[model samples]
Target chain A: MTGAEGKPAPGKEGAAVSGETETAATEVVAGAGAGAEADARVGVEAGAGAGGQAVAGAGAATGVRDRTAADTGAPDELWARLKAYEGRAATVACAGKDPVNAPMIRHWCEAMGDTNPAYEGPDAVAPPTMLQAWTMGGLSGHEGRTDAYDDLLTLLDEAGCTSVVATDCEQEYLRALRPGDEVVFDAVIESVSERKTTRLGTGYFVTTRMDVRVGADLAGTHRFRILKYAPAARRKPRPGRPRPVVNRDNTGFWEGVARHRLLIQRCTGCGTLRHPWLPGCNECGGLDWDTVEASGEGTVHSYVVMHHPPFPAFDPPYAVGLIELTEGVRMVSNVVGVPYDKVRIGLPVRLEFRRYEGAGTGEDPLVLPVFRATEGGA
Target chain B: MAVTADRPVTAAGAELPPLEIPITRTLIVSGAIASRDYQDVHHDAELARRKGSPDIFMNILTTNGLVGRYITDHFGPRAVLRRVAIRLGAPNYPGDTMVLRGTVEQVDGDTATVRVVGANAIGRHVTGTVTVTVPAGGA
Candidate 1:
């Protein structure tokens, strides 16, 4: 969360009573000149640390807290009343004649997982992928809020529903964010549905969409699925790492080998067989390599039945293993066709073709690699 | 509010010149949407408050977008992202305001590395490194 503090800090006493419901109708407008200015180059001492003190100063400026305490019957009505003014958008916008520069863009470059020089040098430009960060407005300025899915809880509570839990998250990326660009953001309530109610009071699934724009250009959109469930119901954990999605790039590799067949990569230079196609060959600096058929014979190199899914799309207590092909190539494959506990390391396994659901449908489906124990092999 | 710029090219132990970028709530939200992250913290303040977050936390994806733009804006349109590594430190809170600063640390061939930082109306919030490939000549 973006605050003076790295983590969620305690909210003011008044914020509790004011309640987000009351503040829901209020809209905050901010810009380059939103708040009291700070020395631009003070670094951390002034920005994150001084921000807390500035809030205190705002509280002291108007001795209204004392006045509100005497007039209102509420314990912290004055404090709550003060919260409206005390709270500001949690983000700090960057604006100037030279908004994008070495330092400015570098920070974002690091954030997006793109540190490629081809994108950030003076003559080089940023890739489209970097746009993901530029469009992000900032963190909610409110303190003590950090969970990614906590908003659903608050909305459910406001709706007289206390049982709410985040079920899953699915995300996709479009454009890349760069420095100096000004962005506009708005969260649109998409759809709220009461799925079903069981022993738990009510099972509701609320989905919200957010729209992003850059100077009137529709940048992208996001959808969130918030699931509200009863507190006592034992919620089944979501699948870990959804089955791997195979695209044109890796489809051939799976179909040929998984169907009791073998496919291998042969170097153009030496005509030696290679399992995986890398950028260059060890023998020759050539990037040339061809996909060829392989023999479906190999020994088990290493195996692991993961009880946990790394990507949240697959259930745990499953198995994954590395197999050494007769061609001296090693491949990572998911181990299946046997009980989880029955699978052992160094057991021989063979290629098996299995169907897996993908992000798309029909003409374009995701494919995965599956392996099974050889009849007499392991 | 006082607005001043010395036009200093570098700071103490800094590698490159300082840089700035105009930030916006729209930019943050759009970045989040583009990344397919619709967490209320980035969009709805009420939702953020209802949850435990003091406010919305800028998703790492959005931060990367803005930072990428910041560098490209300075380097021009031809630059490519070579390697970028960032450790998210402070959250860039909405309305907090930021002024990005950094120093060029190294220059090799068509690539250059920078140590960067983003500060708000209050102070510095993010710090990290960025390396980009420039044209044949240095920027």
Candidate 2:
């Protein structure tokens, strides 16, 4: 879902006809630099070679292999060659396989469970995140993809880094896309990180920046990053529980937990209590809020024992309760000090902190808050 | 601009009723296809397993769409989603049920920011915030 626009669809050729003019414009741009034209031509030939096609000319094949041999001879040389591709076009003026239209938008909404009227009816705009979606080539692949990107990947492949995984993508929306708007985008190889070893393997991170346009108007910018790695040896079983997603909005809560305090948010404007900390007070529409430490008291408002589709870091059949704190705010956490079946509604429980040691996997030691059932409760 | 008289009074701390979404193979495959994501890990079980995933998983676009829907569904059709920022956690595999819950975090005039989280049996699937504007007169 990241990196360049389309994944290479095997055996699909001759899709580049519509992008001929765009490709020509790219060559003109590449012509600005000395020898860039030849580099671009070599890139195309390398792309064809990587696609399982015999090089159109015997001389071209030898030229590609010679460069590959020279580059792969040294790790630093391979990296330098890869870095040289930075700032080159990954795709030039690639038109979206489909125009921003209703049916696709409707299908997307239905699948996402979205029913926003803004995405429907006569005056509708596509979801902003669908910026990359419109540019995808689906199973048939897309046109306008340049050989430079394929050439880069082929270099990595020859170096024994074959697997690829999308790491993340960030998008900025400038204009809302309406139905019937033609989508065209140009992508650049923005950056290539030095080889780094990760839990998955040793790999290089390639980041591409795409500018999506509607006609002449810039609509959005999407930056996608991927890791092209040589698969590491079999991974050790993941240790410990999945780390809780702690962001700025809820960092304070986690910080409080480290200090053995269970804090709840109180609206400054209307004094309403809220849990699972939020930035604003919903009742009084107040941006200002403060936290109050819970009194280490609560009852199980509801409970569920997880038994199936077991998750890592958790033993199955454990009770996860919606603990309603005495302060009138409820939060979910484990209910300990009792058998899973023994956890019942209205059971009195007190706040407790549990510590988990990091397993040397780049994870930090974690302190999480759990609730313990009090003696003779319910 | 719509008048404010008909709009329901929105306040901080208000919780949107939770919705349960069934994670089915059809939903996962169709969602990926609808979003034009041809990643085999999203629609092909065999390929997904080869890729180290237990099964085909939901793509980020679908996750974003669902988050947008969860907000507009509560705020009324007049709600305009200004932004949806989310990070995925547990993979949403088939047969699992993801429950989406939201809390209105802040309301400034007609615009309200809600913190949303979608969780399945494993744990949290997605968490983020959504900014939406509802016309004063609710649709």
Candidate 3:
């Protein structure tokens, strides 16, 4: 059962015992030096050997691992895993029929904080963003090929890709999901191309489409950009420097900064508060607002240290904050004065208006709320 | 096909007049993924046949997007999609055309109500209404 010399042995019970004995016998027959010397191709990286090298490694340990992990020798196991999702497979069919489904209208209503009976009411209906919620729910389980993008990834992985990462997702919603309605999904592979090499490895960029339906009616489509990685050597991080602040927009908030009191608005109808001074409340359809002063203290709901600069005005390793304010509203701002490694969830933060320069010339003072690490809580 | 403007639309009024726009591939695809829908009926011809459908069916998500897009296009780019209520009446198969038609039903200072109808090659595919906020002067 021992595979040939250079091949990797798969991790399976049936093959392990027999393969070990044969492997010992082969070592004796080929001789220690003869095995490596006889197989000159053995020195190049383990996986990418030539046909001759492959034959030599056929019974070897390396061969088995690769074969088993790939869809070669362990077809039954892979097939079993894939079949587990037969019921939950991604499709362009109506969603309502699948009663136990994720991202249904009920789930969306909860996520968007819509409490009105209108969505479920006999006469009233749901909002258009419901589609966005459904899509996010579908993509939550990013591992399977029940959808087009997942199918494409499965195919690429079968074709010998090492790793895959989702780069971007853009969705344009057409309508909202209504009660008693079934949603269908359509998917297609848009394009694939070899992208530039990165620190991780050389990779390819793949794009795919998923079209939705509700029983013969057109819904919306989602375009997904995915990155597939190839093997590469690792690199070290460069010397650290202070991350720069991103403060371009927010002139209006900064103008209010001169007033000395922090001001925010609440919808007159629904009592929902909003920051950045919106004309109306997204909830309750109310236009008039009541101003309130925030305690300027909030918790960091989620944040990331962006290593790559999306725009020229920003630099690497800058902390971007999504803070849930004391007023129960969430806003995206900079988490200033904190070290790169210190940002984490539930970290207490305070607000202070700071000036940020525009990309071109003059610096514009913007009111930015920066978060710092709390002293007591773990 | 070109059609005459149905009626004049005022920005700051109770409600802007309804508009009808044909469904395009872009909007169709957007709705599909926005809803995370992936089925043969929505995109695959052979699969649709296997599933007892005439052809690839239009997705509910895509319908929602189109209806919202149609209203927003008429209202102005700044209008956000607040809510839409519709019941599917008939199937909207590929190659069949559909229209997004709506009318201003009510107006309260900042919010206005619009009733809309989605008709296809058959007749009415979906009928419902939406409430959206327009800038004070459509500015």
Candidate 4:
């Protein structure tokens, strides 16, 4: 039955069918004017008369299409087609593969260094921030992802907007999730913004809204937006010129730069060696300190790749390692000579001095003690 | 009157009492770690500076939690926050205070929408719409 056009069969014949028909009709009404996309674009642009003009010219389709063809470029057709998919399901139908449980919650807490006791023990609830984690398809994706998302992605791909980056996400949690509660969610293509230019590229901001349900109750909504567009003209990575914060207590460490030595501050009173040049020994609160030449050896205690809010001085995804020196203190420094993802924890590294190009002024060159990965890695 | 979560008691344009929260270094870092966000810009000043930020900044999770707290505190024990959609603008930096302000945007049978904005010294730290299910009685 043409649900969109179906009339209610006199006197409630069937409740389910009528409900389905009405919903389908709503979708059809919402998805109206597929053939009048160009005119609608003009209407949106003109903010008034153009859409009325197009609506008036509905019978004069050929004439309007010719004028649109002669006026704007052809990309609007694809944009309009993409817009037609709005309000449609992004995922087919999905459920959390596993119910929310404590073990996963504990692991997430541990990874996040979260000491919040609310997420533990009996009567505990998952962190609201983990709303999306419970819905992830993991290394293997789930069954609910629809073709529209993939098709839209492919369209962007064919248009040379191959690289996709998550711009940002907004999540709303309406209910607390308890362990053993199953999650079900449905995603919709909410809106597609007009093509816009950004530092990254010229692309459309595609937003998908997901309504997460706990049983039949509405629990939350997650709206995620991403840009699907061609890469913009690239800018050169900023040449390193960042000034190291030099101040009391750490000035000696910079002075060691002049001597081509990496100095670790050793508390004279307690003999605790610190790489960061802390003022006092934590063990004894001893302010008296002297230099100990670093043996230039350490292991990667932890590391991260700086990805967002790109900087001029450095490109993103570069590894910054927290190296645990054999001398018993940790120093944060850039890890060079290895791929960023390859810079793993427990990776052995040796300290090396590298002088950055002189900052615009012929001031003393900014020399730094960077760690070079030693042989052997995970 | 103790406004329990079950009392549906609010009207459109009702303003929630403003909350002034301190943004500390520990708040930013611990919040980041709590949210499982290990981005260096959120904790390491040296790294943050190298990345162009003057100092470390707050993570989105902390902002989310703070926003959640703001609404729950107002609605009381029975209100269930059904949705919290927020977008960040200014960074919540340490040594600054973020003041949260909210206006109830809409009130239906048992639900209310609160528009919230958190502002720090520099400017708007975060802004978003929160939809919550109040107890019966049109809060």
Question: How much is the lDDT of residue A57 in candidate 4?
Answer: 17
| lDDT for model 2 | 0.65
| TM-score on alpha carbons, each prediction | 0.29, 0.52, 0.28, 0.46
Model 3 deviation from the true structure expressed as Cα RMSD, one decimal place: 26.4
Tens-digit lDDT track of model 1 for A213-281? 455554443332332322222233443335445565556566664564567767788877765556557
Model 3: how far is A112 from its true place, Å?
A: 22
Best by lDDT: 2
Better of 1 and 3 by DockQ: 1
The weakest ten consecutive residues by lDDT in model 2 chain A span: A28-37
DockQ-derived CAPRI band for the predicted complex in model 4: incorrect
Cα error of candidate 2 at position B47, Å = 2.4
List ranges where model 2 is wrong by over 4 Å: A1-81, A236-378, B1-18, B101-116, B127-139
TM-score of candidate 2 versus the correct structure, residues matched by position: 0.52
For each candidate, what is the lDDT? Answer: 0.43, 0.65, 0.44, 0.60
Residue-level lDDT tens digits of model 4 in A100-212: 88987776665444445556679788866567666665434565666665676566555554433232346667678999899877776666555544433444555666666
Which candidate number maximizes TM-score? 2
List, residue by residue over B98-122, the lDDT tens digit for candidate 2.
8999998999998888888888766
Fnat of candidates, each listed: 0.07, 0.21, 0.05, 0.09
